[model samples]
Target: MHMLSRPSVLRFDWRPTIRTLPEGQFVAAIGDVHGHDHLLAAMHDAIRRELDELGPRSAAVIHLGDLIDRGPRNREALVRARAGIDGASAITLRGNHEDRLLAYLGGSPAALGPWLDAGGEGMFTQMGLDPWRISPGEFRARFGEDLARWLEATPVMHRIGQLVFVHAGIDPALPLDRQDPHTLMWTRRAWIDSPGPYPEGVAVIHGHIPRRTVDFRDRHRIDLDSGVVNWGILSGLVFHGDRMRLLQVS
Candidate 1:
């Protein structure tokens, strides 16, 4: 297991933090995969080993989303994440990338502009499709039918105990149930630069904006995106009994 201390860039605050999970229960939250299937596969194995070392217990795997686009093995990465540990043990949130792809397939031509530049080129290339000529209707008919359904079905946010897992940050100003889905899958500055934890006091675990490394600085939010497709490492956070462990792979 790779250990990461809190990032030094975090601002000073005096709020109390939860250092561990309840006994016999463990949660591992993975970072943005982009399209690196190898890194994700390694992470899966690492989590399995860690769970084994800890002995028998209830465990949950949470994927921070951004499972597609911007990398060399887009399709494979999506398959790996969707297959997950026994399929039922992991919860995958919906990221903005998935949202954009769904929109493009759902007939919003404008959505394709940003989606393509953000990694759609590589994704389409990997799938052997002509990104320039694939019509939204044809894309959906030929290849997007199942993909659209899966992406559309993904939840924008997932919560367990005191941890709220999301593809992106939440608006700390609103109640958890009242949080806008758009904000849950896209907001950045508002939640990251908040004065403190959410008013509800739950810590958020999210991935969207890429960071050079995992972030565990703020007492309220944990960022796991390590820019894996851009030569940075993929990161994961393991929570058990009040304390947490960091896992990463380049």
Candidate 2:
């Protein structure tokens, strides 16, 4: 099993200091991490190191969801998330895999097969459970309260000052808040075609699809998922000032 970052206690005063972030430029957003525990830990550490070097700048980490799936370290990811980096908010979005996990808990036949096919098998293994044939009784006995925690904690989207962070892209035609659930994680060209720069001037940072799989033309959408499940390096974005540094997960 892979190891993930352990939870840390980082203090921050979100009340007024958050208003001090620079008024401009860019911030980072990370792609999907389907249970690749070690890679996510390395990426998180690297981003912190970058922040230390930059100093007193406003920035945030947009996590595009799927923290649990194939790699076997969801618990670790949660711990790290609870640890905050000063002046930086770790915004984690909900992914389709997460939806399936919730549905599986509710005994949804539709979610079971696909969840298993999409590397959810590893997630089950990490939990010390079997995904192949998860009886309803098995879920209740094993995951127990942990399942509820995962669903309750997952976030749908974040609007950090001017940046909009989500697991996927916006509906383009509609306002960010009113976006359809399916479109958030499943949108493609249509969402990209709609005219607008997020909410007026806000830049939207999102992740779900792998960077390698999408056409470079659509790179404007900021895809961070580098497919770590298939030996693909985890990818992330670091924002400092008006420029964003693209990084591959170590």
Candidate 3:
């Protein structure tokens, strides 16, 4: 596997909001995986190599969610994400796609239609079931129950010091504590278009909208969804004290 690395330099304008992690703490935040288990594996290997060179440190590997659907190995990706990298704590967030699955599993039969439309039918196909043919009760007995438990366990947001990690961007108008869970997992243009100072010294790390590359141009937000399902690239942002780096595996 080939890997790409680059120094992540925050611009002066972003200085007011972005803060450093605690001394000797390191965090590797991965973007939306979308069932690319091979890319996820390669990324873990790359992060392990990076950490080896960094010496002893407290570390965490945060997956920015969308761990299932749209690809062939949804269950494999979810399992690997839960296991995380060997030397770091694993933290997983909930994306809108996972929310859809959870809704259907929670008894909203209508949710399955939209979920299937959003590439979830592929997940059922990979599981050797036809999404169109399976009834909700049958699906739950086969796979939904376990998957719902996993998705339910995932938090919508995670915070370590001033770094806030969410599947999608948060509501800029509200304080972190006041944010709606829905906005944390689903907001798009409203969150993206807002020119936010982001509640003072708080920087948001998120993945929802897919892009050709990680979006690091923003002052206080980092968009790491590199369209892995389609583009064949997966990205992660590494945070060490105040310094950051971009890592990508393709």
Each model's lDDT = 0.77, 0.64, 0.82
Estimated TM-score per prediction?
Answer: 0.87, 0.75, 0.88
Q: Which candidate leads in lDDT?
A: 3
lDDT of 2 by residue, 1-250 (tens): 4445543322211122111235543355667877766677777776777777666446667678787777767756655554545568666677777777777777666677877877677766667876666674577557666645656576777776666667767876677678787777667677656645555455566677565642233323455666777755777666654445566664
Best by TM-score: 3
Weakest 10 consecutive residues of candidate 1 by summed lDDT: 6-15
* Per-model C-alpha RMSD: 6.1, 6.5, 4.9
lDDT of 1 by residue, 1-250 (tens): 5443332212122223354467888788998998777778888887787788776368889888888887777777777777777422777788888878778878877888899877788777776779678788877776657766876788999887888999988887788899899998889887667746675678888888788866566777878887886755888877877667788876
- For candidate 2, what is the lDDT? 0.64
lDDT of 1: 0.77
Model 3 ranges with Cα > 4 A deviation: 1-18, 144-147
Q: Tell me how many clashing residue pairs each candidate has.
A: 7, 3, 0
Quote the positional error of residue 90 for candidate 1 in Å.
1.5
